[model samples]
Target chain A: DQQVKQNSPSLSVQEGRISILNCDYTNSMFDYFLWYKKYPAEGPTFLISISSIKDKNEDGRFTVFLNKSAKHLSLHIVPSQPGDSAVYFCAASDFINTGTASKLTFGTGTRLQVTL
Target chain B: DAGITQSPRHKVTETGTPVTLRCHQTENHRYMYWYRQDPGHGLRLLPYSYGVKDTDKGEVSDGYSVSRSKTEDFLLTLESATSSQTSVYFCAISDDRELLGDEQFFGPGTRLTVL
Candidate 1:
């Protein structure tokens, strides 16, 4: 079973517009969520993350909003740029007893294309 | 980005052959992991290591084996190659003090094709 799910396979948006990507989770034990961006033939790079304690977190042009009651989260980018065109993945993880070996469960990923 | 490197960036092998992929890290992080990415499947964890000689299976570990003899190296072996195993594999590492779900730095990934 997929603990995290990104239902949208692809999205297209024009430059200077806001881009929103959504994700859902089924596991309640997950206490932290992360977003990663990937380019073709490259490994996913860390983007932004949010803890369960907070509802929202922002980093520069990227923002992540989480709704615990709904078991959902989203990443928003303002004034999307062509450089933002890539596949985005949402990952979730639960706390570990040792605090060193937390495992991550990832979504199917959403491909975002920014048109000029 | 985390001083991680995956060797044999691209490889094509015939079915039934044994294949091994190597992940090397200079970060000396306590945790290391291997994941496979495929179309529509996202990234699926195959195995992870907490320390040298301490490893565990992830969601998808069938037909695969892993070993960590040193802190800087993690190896994944395919006992017998199958077409179903054709996918891009990634290696990730994070420090011990990092919180759960903290950022995981990944290697460039290795693409493997089994025919």
Candidate 2:
């Protein structure tokens, strides 16, 4: 079963504009969410993350919004640059404790393209 | 990009042949995991190791097996390759599991093809 879903396969935006990618999860036990960006021929790298206790977390150019009620999270990129063009994977994990190991559930991913 | 390396970056094998992929890490992270990436299927976990000699099966661990004899090395073996098993495999590492998902760094990845 696919606990997480990213209905959009791809998205396009102009450079210096805002880009938003959405993800939905079916498992209610998940307590943490993360976004990873990947380029061609390379593995994904960590971009941003948000805890269930919080609604929004922002980095320099990336922001992650988590809505626990709806079990949905979104990644927002402001003034997106051409470098931002890549596949974005949304992942979630359930909380146990600081010492316990948690496995992540991932969505299919959304390919974002930024053009100048 | 992490301190991890996957051997045989690209390999093409025939069906029913035994194959092994190696993931070696230099960071000495306590947690290690193996995942496969396929189009429209995202990343699916195969198996993971929490500590040396400590391992567990993931959602898609049927045809795969993993072993960790040392803290820095994790190995994945396919008993008999199948056409459906062709995919890009990634090895990830993380230190602690935080309230918000801990960051897991991925290796360059190994692309395997079964003919």
* Per-residue lDDT of model 2, residues B1-115, tens digit only: 5799999899999999999999999997888999999999999988898889988888799889999999999999999999999999999988766432477899989999999
| Candidate No. with top lDDT | 1
**In model 2, what is the error at residue A111, expressed in angstroms?**
0.4
RMSD of each: 1.3, 1.8
Cα lDDT, model 1, residue A40 = 96
Chain A TM-scores, candidates in order: 0.96, 0.95
lDDT of 1 by residue, B1-115 (tens): 5799999999999999999999999988888889999999999999888889988888899999999999999999999999999999999998664553467789999999999
Which 10 successive residues of model 1 chain B have the least lDDT summed? B95-104
Cα miss at A43, model 2 (Å)? 0.9
In candidate 1, chain A reaches a TM of: 0.96
Each candidate's lDDT (Cα)?
0.92, 0.91
Error of 1 at A57 (Å): 0.2
Q: Highest TM-score among the candidates is held by which one? A: 1
Could you give the fnat of all candidates in order?
0.76, 0.67
For each candidate, report its DockQ versus the true two-chain complex. Answer: 0.73, 0.65
What value does the lDDT take at residue B13 in candidate 2? 99
Model 1 clash pairs are: none
